[model samples]
Target: MGNVFDNPSFFSKYMELRSDYNYNDYLEHPAMESLLPPLKGRSVLDLGCGYGAYAMSFMRKGSSSYLGIDSSSHMIEKARTENAGAGISYRVLDLKSLDTLSTVFDVAYSSLVFHYIEDFDALLRNIYAILSDDGVLLFSQMHPLLTASYGYSGYFEGDYFAFSSYQEEGRREGRWFKEKVVSYHRRLSSIMNSLSDSGFIVDRVLEPIPREEDIREFSQLERDLVRPTFLCIRAIKKKSK
Candidate 1:
């Protein structure tokens, strides 16, 4: 297992989990579930599209074309190998720059990606640039409250089951135990502001409450901690001047 925080593409674990793990209970959130039906026949761009799950899923639904880009060449290679399919393309890309392609998509999306970005402003700005006028953008991410989560401060020794004291930033040091990894947490307000400032219209924010069946499927500990794993969003690019 690589450092999941830093390596955007180091999602071998996630890919395996999500590849065939779509359950209505787990997907009770409309944000992720809604992405499919509307995407049939649409040209789509996926940013930080780790392992190409979401993007490839779109193409599987008969999407016209799919282009997936990510910061992790390692993950991109895996995405290319495992998820490549009809009309789908995967490339190694940096969110701060997307010169590899231009405003050629009908819709775009990303899942659990923005939280890792260091520059929210440059990221949204670049995303806004490649979108066709009024093109839709959908995304999901860890809730901003994650900044206050235990593991962030290195206060926990292991995935909420451990312990530590976060008296200072010095707590962030011990990740060498794994391979490549990097990430940054951002506030929800700041994310919304960045999207707005970058010329997009917010459609809705999806903060889902898991269902009873979900509780039944999760372990007691997971049920308690799985409070909410994702923040789904829908937005549209402002028409070009």
Candidate 2:
């Protein structure tokens, strides 16, 4: 398989792990929600929208339309099977092919997705093009600090690749997945500059710290209080002159 996500068993296990409270639930999701703009009556493009976790939410919140795209067919299948809403549709499409998107969106969101693709600039440029002028693009990615360390030193050692195998924790016990996932790490400055060069005006950058309530439920998250593992961002497509 090209990446761990493309493997059937791995993707299956990942779907099963949706209820768990490790990274997705405890850390990333809240931060992403915090950065989101109003959804009512908007058209949304959800890039890397694995399993469509946020699909129905967009529809329920009154989005006029919602298109959720992921690279994995397995994920798209699960998304369609599990989630049903009038205005939401899920498709299998890789991030690099965003240039093929013809539909314009009022808001675009990608949660914990961008780190897997190395061509960050091109990805942003395509998203910028697909967005209506002044549309918002909100996303989250693996933090540069955590990626630079990988398990060791934290002194911003430049870009590199890291691999992971999923597991379960925090009152939940099981093998979440059985494959090695790979991601690329770029410096914070590089990430910012790439977005700016791609015509995204950075509105806010968030380094999410675990909430006290989350830590109460998942005590291990207290470690993350010191070193945030994820970065959530909100940017806008610049208006044409």
Candidate 3:
């Protein structure tokens, strides 16, 4: 559950998938687009911003300043090497190392990352403390029921939930490794409860229906199991009473 960056394949895949979408400005752009409304004219912190794709999108949306933090060097390398622009920067950081970031942010966003975290409450508090007053936290995670009920991901089908993992042959020779990631498998009520307890007000949650093209491009397994994505979560820090 820790340092998912240890898997080289994930890094390699990160470079390939996200970079392609960043350049294409289409496929992954919607998720990026949905994150922008919260960041307009605000200082932003992008936690687990893989390869800075979402951070780059944030910049294009006119965020005043941006900082991206992730535990993966390979992802950080891709970000700092080519993605930095227009008052945006990337740092290699684990979630627990939140204090290393210098400035409080107006918006903090993450995508497809938090489900891997073992302790969601601690992470949420860390994120909440780092934000400025009324700061919004926008995140997209693997849908718990979707991943739990489905088998594979990526090719969009909006079919069902899936949360399974197994080992494939490694690219490099060595001891076989384990992929031990686990999800919270929560309903919408459970998700809301966690945020409410963490001092956040759940502002909105949107589940997007996939387009017809998504079902066609994907394999049958993806079509069968990949249910609609519980796509966006926008939560605002509780204002002081």
Candidate 4:
């Protein structure tokens, strides 16, 4: 509905599922955080910050300020309503237009949103422009392995894969809620190469697996523990003097 991500009804249901299960709390978020440097007293730009969930986490960890942007008004509204407080703001803005943001951030945090964007080069360039000289970018996406697991030709070459899903929209599904969505798959090389071309130095990469404790609680995650479902990256903007 509404291009897979902008629908109000779908987001409402999706947010419900998020809160019910802490779905992302256990997955890529923890692994991504482990790769990040201290964020205390830092300003953050949260791209595709759905419902400001990760933004709230950053703010709680002593981030000086958090600006969350997304393309869905419903998600923005829910974020503003649920996450209203000091050191936080939410806006309905598309990632393709990141130049509109004037503030330079010390950390630009995005999670599981890049695959939805078709123009990785432009998006990374825009992020590089608004980032401070030493700004760090931390983000996660659907792992290339997971995409290949679905079976596709040219798995090694840079390519795009499209699929239709009427049940869910994230790397993993919760029990209660589902919605119609579309997915775009691209090669890992293309993702990293684009970051390099956009003036970012790739520092670390992680194909996250479920921790032993996690699999102990949710035994269903044992399969994911063996095979990574998500990829995380840490990079820094190489701003020229």
Best by lDDT: 2
lDDT of 1 by residue, 1-241 (tens): 2326334433554454455534323643355766533776688888887667666567777789998888777778878888877798888777767755665787878877776666777777777777778888888875554433334433112465332342221112233224333455565676788788889888878766655665566543243345445678888898963
Name the candidate, 2 or 3, with the larger TM-score value: 2
Q: lDDT scores for all predictions?
A: 0.64, 0.77, 0.65, 0.74
lDDT of 3 by residue, 3-32 (tens): 646578655654565544331232224654
Q: Please report the TM-score between candidate 1 and the true structure.
A: 0.75
Q: Give the candidates in order of lDDT, highest first.
A: 2, 4, 3, 1
Off by over 4 Å in 1: 1-30, 35-37, 149-181, 220-227
Model 2 has how many clashing residue pairs? 0
The better candidate by lDDT, 1 or 4, is 4
Which candidate ranks first by TM-score, i.e. highest?
2
Ranking by TM-score: 2, 4, 3, 1
* TM-score, candidate number 4: 0.82
Cα error, residue 159 of model 4, in Å, equals 22
